[model samples]
Target: MGHLFSKRKSRVTEHDKALLQLKTTRDKIHQYQKRSEATVEKDRQLAKKLIRDGKKERALLLLRKKKFIEEQLKKTDGTLDNIEKMIQDIEFSQIEMQVVDSLKIGNESLKQINAMLSIEDVEHILDETQEAVEKQREIDALLSGGLLTEEDETAAEEELDAIIADAIQKRLPEAPTDVENPEVVLPDVPETLPEAEKKAQKEKVAMAAS
Candidate 1:
């Protein structure tokens, strides 16, 4: 009777152990599934961000290329005008020497104007390209969680406003009232550094001066 009781007890203990093992295995499988789902969601978000970034980059490149082509076309048109003028001058039989000289001066002036225009166009293109790059960086930082701060968002908004203001100023003439009351305000400059840093910087400056 005692043996029978011991055998029964051992059987129950074995069953409980099996049940616990099974539960642990099930729990592990569930945890694995949850982790996988989270990973997949993260990857999806990253992929979406990458697609957006790529589109922005492509758009900026296209804009820059278009602007460059337009500038080239303008320069080519100016060159064509000069060429036609030269051809006309060659065909003229009663062209006075003074008229020929004047045409030469006009051609020179046109060349200078074209050069200045080209420089201005190139500078404008550079500025726009830099702005596009900066915007992309900002977007990248935001998507990557690097700039997940209210201050960052506020700064981005200010920068965007400044960019819009600049564009508006370029496209429209300033009103007299606008000139009198500037919409943009300059940021305050720091007048002094931290005490320790200031002392260190002053020492460095003294050393450099010496």
Candidate 2:
């Protein structure tokens, strides 16, 4: 939340100030150039008028002054170009500074993370976790009558098999435990049945076959 509300610090530096000053100089030069151009044109027109009025020396002097002002204006144009190049260099330098600052921040963040989770620290945490899991398993074994143990995997397996067998036995029908002996009276056995019974038996056999 603090980060969300915080304002970023200004990145402006000496280079920016220098650039502003240079631009100011360039603008002043531009104004001077305009004034110089106006002066040159005025001189040129005055010189022509002087020549028509037969003041040849004065017209020549005015022409000389006009040439000097044009030279100065040209020099100012070169200066303006240099200033523009300087401004571009300063701006590019600012971008470079930003890149460097970003790299520094990334490096610092990595350092902090490494410090927090060093190799030794991570190894220690893993060992503690393994020990805790082993202790929990022991506790569970004690609670379950020590039937489960890491060192005795066969015992745990045998216990599971026994439990399954018990479940199966419970699901099966119980066998009769009480036996009653009954006497049977002997009856006469005839070698043949009556005609109707014999015929009915034959029809039942035929139906089953079909």
On lDDT, the candidate that comes out on top is: 2
| Residue 77 displacement in candidate 1 (angstroms) | 69
Clashing pairs in model 1, backbone N/Cα/C closer than 3 A: none
**Candidate 1 on 119-191: residue-level lDDT in tens?**
7788999999999999999999878978668897788656654554454346554334346659765554344
lDDT of 2: 0.78
TM-score of each: 0.21, 0.49
Local distance difference test scores for all models: 0.59, 0.78
Model 2 agreement with the true structure over 111-179: per-residue lDDT tens digits: 777887889899999999999999999899788867645658677555544554454456556543334
How good is model 1 by TM-score? Answer: 0.21
Q: What are the runs in model 2 whose C-alpha is more than 4 Å off?
A: 1-7, 113-210
Residue 203 in model 1: shift from native, Å? 99
lDDT of 1 at 151: 92
Stretches of model 1 off by over 4 angstroms after superposition: 1-12, 55-210
